[model samples]
Target: MDELKLGLDLGAVAEALAAGEITERQAKNASKFINQVKAVHEKPLKARLIQSDRGQFLGEAHPLDCGAWKAYRYGPEFRDGGKVFPSLEDAEQFIING
Candidate 1:
């Protein structure tokens, strides 16, 4: 079997599998290999600390890959408030206000 290249789209592989062009094992292997490669190359999103006007730490905001930002309130544990913002500024505001 040919080695699957990095960044292979699993959608195409699924289509191939459904079309009976590739075996189930081959499709699973391709998916696993692609995910492994993605995991190795992808880095965790670092949350930027949000501060108040008085220089007090509010919380943190992490930018997502989908052009959105997620805010987490700082406390005993960093917890997401179940809200997604369109921009980092919006997320920071949420952290500050909430």
Candidate 2:
């Protein structure tokens, strides 16, 4: 996986804590902050995003077929039972913009 750039300043947080400008709790919270990261290397579908002439993006179900690109989690049964995209467009936009 590629390293992600988190635009945060650890030194600044340390300085603020040292100067008593921020609580130790706040500094600790800042230090432990996590950014959401998800990989989109696989298709939400069985085919490529731009497969043959029958691209799903152009089908009648285009805008609603979000299972292809949205992130999801499997239950203990490995079922499709976790978070899903609100729409295909939203997922596509996120991938394109990010």
Candidate 3:
């Protein structure tokens, strides 16, 4: 059998959960999988980035950023073409428009 790897973004997964498309257990499973992967890679297990008041960079596409957005329950707007939106309201509008 071929071993195929799959990748999942926690923000996207949380969005699914918030939208009622996925269950809380599913989100937890995803998080567990991510933690296991990090352990294998010898990486720290954190789920949020502290963007300083000046908006400092926390590495390219850090996982904490994902967790922060997920915690904000901003997944629905994010998936509906609002990924680049500067505000959550704007993201919702984008979702309504598109």
Candidate 4:
């Protein structure tokens, strides 16, 4: 996997800890930094409305916590209720089609 832009390889850190190549304290520090990075990158989840070429309002696409996208038809009170797609393109397609 690609190393994080912060120059921390979390997977490598865990592996090094398991292999006794780094002290527990060092691993803990790395973990802390990783969590900080996550906090910085995290965004509040908000659904954006999808529109068709003719300006017809589709439903919404939600960014899932697991790094997937979800497209849902408009439910009562604008609730999300649909399938998850691996990419935003797929989600948009589903929103446009279904």
Q: Which candidate is the best by TM-score?
A: 1
lDDT of 3 by residue, 1-98 (tens): 00111353556666767888767877787767766776767866443333334665221112333332222223354343213444444433433434
Error of model 4, residue 6, in angstroms:
36
Model 2 Cα displacement at 9 (Å)? 0.7
Give Cα distance to truth, residue 86, candidate 2, Å. 28
**TM-score against truth, every candidate:** 0.49, 0.33, 0.34, 0.48
Candidates sorted by lDDT, descending order? 1, 4, 3, 2
- Where's the lowest-lDDT run of ten residues in candidate 4? 1-10
Candidate 1 C-alpha lDDT tens digits along 5-63: 45478887888789898899989999988787777668754779889999999888878
Give me the runs in candidate 3 sitting further than 4 Å from their true place: 1-5, 43-98
Clashing pairs in 1: none
Off by over 4 Å in 1: 1-44, 80-82
Error of 3 at 98 (Å): 69
lDDT (CA) per prediction: 0.80, 0.43, 0.45, 0.77
All candidates in order of TM-score, best leading: 1, 4, 3, 2
Q: RMSD (Cα, Å) of candidate 1?
A: 8.0
Question: 2 or 4, which is superior by lDDT?
Answer: 4
Global CA lDDT computed for model 2: 0.43
Which of the predicted structures, 3 or 4, would earn the higher TM-score when compared with the native?
A: 4
